[model samples]
Target: MTTHSPHPVRPGHGLTVADAMDPCDYQIADDSTVDQADNILRSAHIDYLVVRDHNGRCEGLVTRTGLHPFLTGSWYTERTAVSTTTHQRGPFAWPSMGLSLAAIAMRVKRLAVWPVVDDDGYLLGVLTASRAAGVLDAVTTP
Candidate 1:
């Protein structure tokens, strides 16, 4: 079944990235195996996993696509680390960012899920492309 944002976003309105982001509940250790990350992505029906370091800090992101080779290639039996497949460690949004700008960045970068972080670089949540487009369709739609 498909889901959508309940409310539509209007540019120039008071809406913010916080309004469109979902909580950061799902995560995987950087040292985790590619197979492990794949299992979580499949089970959770999510495209990405927030990779965390030993100290529990947000490290980077690992996508199902990143693990595809390991899952299907000769390395399927190998315990490839999730960190090796992770990306997007530096680009993240803040709660106060305008939805318009966030949407633009996601579009330009072709990001399926953009991480949202707090002032101290702690993860707050993620801005999914589907959710952002659903609500901010007006802004993105010509």
Candidate 2:
């Protein structure tokens, strides 16, 4: 599903990235296997995973494409190790951030997925490229 912006995002809409970020949809534990991550991505139909540690703190993110090397090669059996080493850190946005700023950060960082965190760094949800585009479309549409 896509989120529609209420109106055209203007220079002074005062809307923050948190306002546009989708609810938390993807989640996985630190110890979860690569296969498990892959299954979640397939089932959820999303490309990112919000990795949490034992205390449920945000650790990082792992993408579907990032697991390809470990899933299809002579080192396929090395899934566990690959997952442990390749966990990518999730980028963050505060609730007060502007949509324009968030969009710029995503683009400049080449991030397909970014996470929303609270003051304590608690994982709130994710902001994906596709979802962001949807918001843009909604806001720009009459």
Candidate 3:
């Protein structure tokens, strides 16, 4: 039997990408020099940074490995790290996914981190496995 509840499901309300993501200021502009980007990454103490363009659009990702080649290259000091990102990103965490079993899916994947993007592919934020677990716990706890 279908029982009526006071709060019905909304289209897109809770646990959205915006809610689950660990908001960070670790985005590096695409035009920034490799040195500049490296500094940011170092200061943030993170292995990955969301790569954004002039319009603040998600271009790709910049990881420690992605920057490895440049570290040994002669032009490393002069080149931009944007082009070194992993173009074919593994998975993107969309805000809409949080509506369903997306968080569970990510947890199952065991990804260290992933990017959260909007419909327009803008840089929303980053998501970590621990953060996803926290969301799952919160949703299941009560």
lDDT tens readout by residue for model 1, 1-142? 9999898855646668998999877899989888888889999998788988887778878887777877788645757888777367866888899877898898998887888888877788999888877877765568
Candidate 2, residue 97: lDDT = 78
Residue ranges of candidate 2 with Cα displaced over 4 Å:
1-13, 78-85, 133-142
TM-score of 3: 0.69
Rank candidates by lDDT, best first.
1, 2, 3
Candidate No. with top lDDT: 1
Query: Global CA lDDT of candidate 3, please?
Result: 0.69
lDDT of 3 by residue, 1-142 (tens): 9989798765333666667777757777788777776777888788887778789877767777777777777755666556554443645777667633665666676556777888788867777777766765766664
RMSD of each: 8.7, 7.2, 4.7
Clashing pairs in 2: none
lDDT by residue for model 2 (1-142), tens: 9999898757435656776788876788887888888888998898778888778878878888788777876766634732374756855787787777787788888887788888877888777766776676676677
Which 10 residues in a row give candidate 1 its minimum summed lDDT?
Answer: 7-16
- State the weakest 10-residue window (summed lDDT) of model 2: 76-85
Candidate 2's displacement at residue 125, Å, is 1.3
> How does model 2 score by TM-score?
0.77
- Among these predictions, the greatest TM-score belongs to 1
Better of 1 and 3 by TM-score: 1
